[model samples]
Target: MRLTRYLLALFLGLGLCAGPGLADTPGVGLKPDLRLLVDISGSMKTSDPDNLREPAIELIVRLLPEGSKAGIWVFGEDVRELVPHGVVDSAWRERAREAVPQIDNSGQRTNIPAAITAATYDLERLDPGYRTSIVLLTDGKVDVAESPMVNASSARRLLSATAPNLGATGIAVHTIALSNEADWPFLRALARSTSGIAEKAESPQALSSIFVQALEMVAPTARVPLSDSGFAIDDSVSEFTLLVFFGGARNRLELVDPDGARYSANSSDVDWYQNQQFALVTVASPSAGNWRVKAPDSASLRVNVISDLKLDVDPLPNSLPAGRQTELGLRLTEQGQVLTDAEVLAAFDLSVVITGPGGKQLSIPVSREYALPADGEYRIVIPPFDAPGRYQVVAQLQAQSLQRELPMYVEVVAPPEQPTLVTRGQEPPEDDFQAPLLWLGGVLALLLLAIWLHLRRRKRRKLEIWEKRARQLASNDSEPLEGVSADQ
Candidate 1:
């Protein structure tokens, strides 16, 4: 019955149908439809004391591409939509950034089910060309009530019914669990069942990095590598955004362009947002040459760009059956055309680094020799994945003047084991088989009946203990807790 309730809720909330013209390809060039669900329950006051979630979310909002769709929701005893769902344009991004400050840890309970329902409500109405994903950040269990059993039952319904339905409809639910007390098992299961990534943050400071990783999973961006706080802006790069991380002092970040002209937040062509922890800056039509950031030696920077030159990896399936080998295709393209110059391809070293379920690393080199067709695409055969868990694959390309990395996540699932059959040289006589089967059936019936009675008695004893405790509290003029049904 609980599963039925979950299904009904999901049906009404999500529309329970694949959108018309949904992309048949799993992980190609589809645009992203991202929903961010943040938990603002009381426990977050400890887990994220400084409220770094605000800046972390702002980082995501600023980095989103112009055409994608996104929305933000904060959850506690109930769910509230902080940002309305719409196409990601300049105005939408500004509104989302403004809404980030409203997230706070002041709620009485963590109602994850309600949050999911609200975040995904009417998601089927979106354009079928986009890939739907939900990034759920939480710091506690499903605490809709005082009883742990009730919370556990709610979790079960969510995993058993809702998660599968979401996966079936091509929606990924990426989960982030904060603090040691967070419900890791439930969060991990929810992500695994929906073909999403599961991440844990031991400290609030880690939320920003984890948010960046989650963004990579949902909507990866083309990045221009930053080395020693310096990077080159090629002619193909139309726009570039710099994410600089720093600590200690509150100082303005400055950039030195190709002509050695220094620029800061006050510069004409730069858009900058700064907080205590980090600063995000976007520069349009940057000059083509070497550029450097003026920051402390200990500071770090990441440059993401919108460019004509890009590293393209073949789309990876959301999941793969265990012990199956697959081929991965990689290529370099400039302005939508594959690069076929031998000298250009020979300048870079390309490799694939795979992290398996047990944290083992496997590095496979992508041969410089192009395939028979002479196309720029490089192909590598991924070895059979023997373990049943999530695998992270990163394709890295490094050359004298450029660096690029593409990260992809895939889940490997083991098929159910078949029962082994034992056979004898001779079959038993029909009469003997009939008699033994009847006797065995009687014994099994008796065993099942005994098990039922023992369970009933044990449940009754537990109920009596709870009832006694409740009555004692009531006698002391304390608030009485709600009763839990045995069926739960």
Candidate 2:
């Protein structure tokens, strides 16, 4: 009990400091915002050889594209934007170079989720014209707080929450794991979710090369302006999705399928981004032939299409008892076939939304590791419901253009009925007398033991008294016992 109390106290303490606060004030930066999130927690001071982190930052700053704008954020227990995003001129470069050394190893905790969130905020502040990407460098696993609630699962949920923001803003997150202790899988997933890259650095000296590699990944490798000339996919291709990114007011865009079926930006399959800068359309089993597009020539388009990845959640149970643990299954497939290997689908986001009897909603946290344990089967454990009524579990996956929501309803029944034994041709067995008999026997045994002890004590006292009287009589006879009195 004492140990349990101590552990509860510890968790409470951690929960108090779990939040990563907020990011620093907005800095001035345009698109192509390379937000460098460097870990400067106390642990880095030791893991970093000769404190070479600063030198790596200096090298990255020097190599930044002259046309691009950037910012520097250092994260530990708290996130601080050391240098806000600004144009990469000689002056800005020099400022960044000097500011690199100013970042000291003074932080005591490494709040990785907060760092990602802060970087996302920085990119969000920029216009859609500016391509946004983040380069995260860390040497340890997420250690935001020391508590039972702050584990790898918690970190994943935090990442899941921030991933959509990055996706909506088209901000890629590239990560460089500095040491073996780093959460490499989580970092890789974060990068993959945003269409970025993940790499590892053997030592601090290798940081510069890895940073360049990340930069290359974030850089635009190709530019094909889609206007009068539209791209097409042959029938040989299985599935594809086209993401059209633009800026300014909404453009009137049209897509013509191989069968001459016309689809506008308002089509059901087409999703117009709330950001007002992009439209996403998924074409499953694309038909062979030339697909045409019609749009205002003034509107520029950057098209991104991918294939061979799809997420689906298995059917949920029709009914569940209120306040009972229930597991929801999820599956991932490629081209309509379920995937046997879990690693291939680790980059996707799987979450659960629960609606209670009172219309209250809650999102449960899930971990990637849990899915692999069951080979692509994600079992989401739902807490017992408090009221018996209709409850819902909505399983959702946000992977690139293939976002799916699967909701299942279950009617929570009241607690199980108590069974009563029935007998034919005989009176119902009265309450078993064993309990009363046991109690009576216990009382009788205790009374008998007490009486026996009392009798033994009394016998011992009588014996002692007789022995004393006999000794006194013998002594009187030995003393001549008043010889005259005896003769009388």
Backbone clash count for every predicted candidate, in the order shown: 0, 6
Q: What is the lDDT of residue 219 in candidate 2?
A: 39
> Model 1, 26-127: lDDT tens per residue?
344567889999999998999998999998998899888888999999989988999998899989987987888999998889999999999779856756
Q: Could you give candidate 2's per-residue lDDT for residues 257-327 as a string of tens digits?
A: 86889887566764433224344455666665567776655454433333333344433333444577767
Model 2 alpha-carbon drift over 4 Å, by segment: 1-31, 122-125, 220-488
Q: Please give the RMSD to the true structure for each candidate, in Å.
A: 23.6, 22.8
Question: What TM-score fits each model?
Answer: 0.70, 0.39
Model 1 clashing residue pairs (backbone): none
Structure candidate 2, residue pairs in collision: 31-130, 32-130, 32-131, 323-384, 323-385, 324-384
Name the candidate that leads on TM-score: 1
